[model samples]
Target: MTFRECQRCGTCCEKGGPALHEADLGLLEHIPMSDVVCLRRGEMAFDPRTQSLQPLSAELMKIRGKDRGWECIYFLSQAKTCSIYSHRPLECRSLFCADTAAVLEAMAVPTLSRQDMVPQESALWDCITDHENNFPVGQALRLAKAETDFAGSICSELDDLIRREIHFRQVLADRVQAADRDLWAYLGRPLWLVLLPLNPIFSRYEHA
Candidate 1:
């Protein structure tokens, strides 16, 4: 089928929300921070353009999905239309499933980060920075990919780290008075959830 325009089929929105770009900064006035999520750098996320998982080159702040699923929060499932159609992010406006050139080009552009969303002088920013340093995702990835478990120590250590991280996230949320819906955006997804992409390997280690 030859496609020339968007049919508002909800295919794109159903897949996932778009990452915000510099041009979409102004749209933040209407979009709540709770509706966004920060994919930390070095984290493995599904790249729609490549249709596979890849480590992010930089931090990416994107809209959170609905009910913890990939469907865009703004998508009205029954109507198959975007609630914020008029003020959608740049990536949303550039999407054309039939001719993805525009969307692919848009993906190449730099994305907005959590740092950009919070004021540098704010105390919450300090917490964010401290959290990033205390639980560097890159370090966790290295440990997970290490050549040997050595008496299952690596897995043991990782299990502990995961537990500590969970506690830390809760503490941070309390300190910032952030709701559960907003915690993912404020601190990134849980370490265990992020490690899910490693699959049977991580699972094996967990059980070992």
Candidate 2:
């Protein structure tokens, strides 16, 4: 078997950082939301490999990679080093883009969950899961991203989606003070971030 040795060329880092999977959840206690983002199912991203819109199957907590245009937030471009090299995620440790077999195999494993949690953390986790399931933003988001022919339906879905977000925020805020921000994190990136990609579709509908 052959393996690729990294040349410290920084090409991989520029491609972006590894996602935060089940094994990486513990790092959240130390990593701030500014550096990491949770991607909900609603965000429609183009998948180059699939040549289609890549819809998420589950909630994905990923590192914010575009701070420097698709570069990892922890990437020190000038020095060609990762700022948080010592504490990188497991996916990062297993990855070697030149020989992607390991990373591909790792992805087949189920996402990790907290085996043991204290009462407070457990409560929050439960609420997050419940809200995510109950709200079902995927359909609304998909409709909102559709072509102009679905303008009326898109409008309706967007309204419903926003209302659901507001209601969920209320539920979270009731559980703890200042949880509105946490709501965004739990839903993945900021609401505006999700909206950015769909803005063009929205504009076309409005004008038409």
Candidate 3:
């Protein structure tokens, strides 16, 4: 299997399934943050939604599931293409098909097996590392990562810590939005509030 072998079936591209990454955020410069969808603290949502974000409690919220999670608002269904293809995020570009996997393995760098690919964690890490590199949506990534890692029991005690931080940041964002009557004002601030308290742990990853 190889990249050239891809049929461009678009089976993997439809329905807003893939999570956004830091590089995706960078590629999405032209798209307003309001237009992109994201999962925050295990909840699915887009900007301007009237209700709380949807909790991803079931497998249906996954890419392998029927609904395939949230779709990108800019994705064009008719052409089976991304409306913002050129500027699409890194995660989108990084996604490999069966052919791509075979090619990579043939070249000697065995990609992780499918069972090892935790889409949520990978997306969360991409967001965090990229946000730290100065992307605007990193705050959301921080919240998402905290929620994801906490839920996985990787460090169970950190679950409450992360949740508390997420709640605090959400409250702060709400206040900022109320005062400024704008959502962008709250974007970067959440990361600041959440990361400040975890400076000891985060500092280790700063150089990573």
Candidate 4:
């Protein structure tokens, strides 16, 4: 049987929050920065088309998951309703599991990046840029692979980088009086957590 309208089963919402696109810019005011996280370029993330984790070609802002899990933060699971149905992101509005043509086409369009979300001249934007350049996930993942499979001598360097990542965010937070949630929203997740999937060794540095 073909379904004509949404069943509100929450299947799509449970998979993960939709990636923000240009059309969703107007809705940003309704969505708090603390609820967003930039999936930086080169970071490995779930690719719906491929059904596997693939490195993102470009940075895209996504609604952070509930309690760091993949469930869309705005999804009201028990009630089976959207917290912001009136003005959900473009991907959300476009998605239809039965026929994903609309959603796939929406994915082809340019996504909203960190620069698009924040003013280019602001200190906050500068800090985000610096963090991306200085602590890139690709470089960290490469270092982790080397440590796990090769010389293992680079452990110290990787450890140092992890510590620097913590300090970098700490100093920026103190200077700007930014809260931890805001810091995560602006700079993406911590390096240690991001690297955890690549290597279990990084788990020890989680609290560092």
Candidate 5:
């Protein structure tokens, strides 16, 4: 199946649940935190139990106990669409059904595998790798040079850059959180438990 062949039944959209990334927060600047609602509390922050990070809140928690697992406030069942579609989140944009997956993979964009990613810690490594590779080399060099002569102005810009970088880091963290959960389920084992026993064996093999 391919993307072109997709019937756009929106089945995946209806059944599919994708969380937001840090970079996606920029889109929420116009949206007040008061109006936004969190779907899953666990989805909004780093879950130590699952070792995953949650998405950001568009609006602060208004109704008590309203924000908990799976269902999102932004999801509108009537329209059969996300209320915040433009700013929806990396997970939402990247999610695909079988047909979409085949199309994306053919285009050379990496597609998620149920085996590769878990719902909790989805695509974190890829996010980190992308951020690392996407850093602006020219801008960094210019900032470094400008700091020496125009410390005050450059400092302000540097602060903004730092914030942006931090946002990107958050995106990576979110991905890790999702992937970690997925991996745990996939391996059918806790990460620590599996790695502790396997590390030494793999190390020995590497040396050989």
Candidate 6:
């Protein structure tokens, strides 16, 4: 098989910005929060074991990118360059879709330790903390629980917590923008998405 060399075509960026790695924490303050988003515990993730996108049991901070289209936020479609190319995440630099070995090896690299993050003394950060703590990834079975039962009136407590987080992210999103806003964007999605609970993370590292 002839291996194709990368041509900087931005197709990978369409898969979304690289997940934040431990090495990429340094770029946090340099990049606008408008360009980042956190993946909470309850959100679905692919379980290599099950070959399914199951909800994880912990929080993960990642760069915000296009939802349905898979475009990285920093990717400039017009010019075909990353707006933050010089400081792109480690995965962004190491990933080479055409190179199977490289792609497999890169998968083992861990994302930025949430422990490395120094929470700012602000309401937004507090809100984020609240969201993670309130609707924790306490049960992997949450993925299997009928949504109507897990996060519905049957679980009004969780439902209310989810609503608060939605409002929190929406209100905070308006505050952070590309206009030199220092914090990461707090773009919350639908309420149902917010209510899924996660199991504990596989790692031993303490999170912020």
- The top-ranked prediction according to lDDT is 4
Q: How close is candidate 6 to the true structure, as a TM-score?
A: 0.65
What is the TM-score of each predicted model, taking all chains together? Answer: 0.86, 0.66, 0.35, 0.91, 0.29, 0.65
lDDT of 3 by residue, 8-118 (tens): 567656534444432233443475544432222322333212334443331111112122234545556677776667775444565556534432333232222211222
Candidate with better lDDT, 2 vs 6? 2
Counted clashes in each candidate structure: 0, 2, 4, 0, 15, 10
| Tens digits of per-residue lDDT for model 2, 80-183 | 98888878887778777688778766666565322222243577677766666665657556555663665333566565665665666666677677545444
Candidate 4 has a TM-score of 0.91
TM-score (C-alpha) between model 5 and the true structure: 0.29
Off by over 4 Å in 5: 1-17, 30-69, 99-208
Local accuracy of candidate 4 as per-residue lDDT tens digits, 19-55: 9888888998899888888887888999888889999
Each candidate's lDDT (Cα)? 0.80, 0.61, 0.39, 0.83, 0.38, 0.56
Q: Write down the lDDT that model 6 would get.
A: 0.56
Kindly list the per-residue Cα lDDT of model 1 for residues 10-81, writing each as its tens digit.
888998999999889999998988888888999988987678999988888899898747799999999998
**TM-score-best of 2 and 4:** 4
Model 1, CA-based lDDT? 0.80
The most accurate candidate by TM-score is: 4
Is 2 or 6 the stronger prediction by TM-score? 2
- Comparing 4 with 6 on TM-score, the higher-scoring candidate is 4
Provide the lDDT at 41 for model 5. 16
- On TM-score, who's better, 1 or 5? 1
Model 4 lDDT-worst window of ten: 145-154
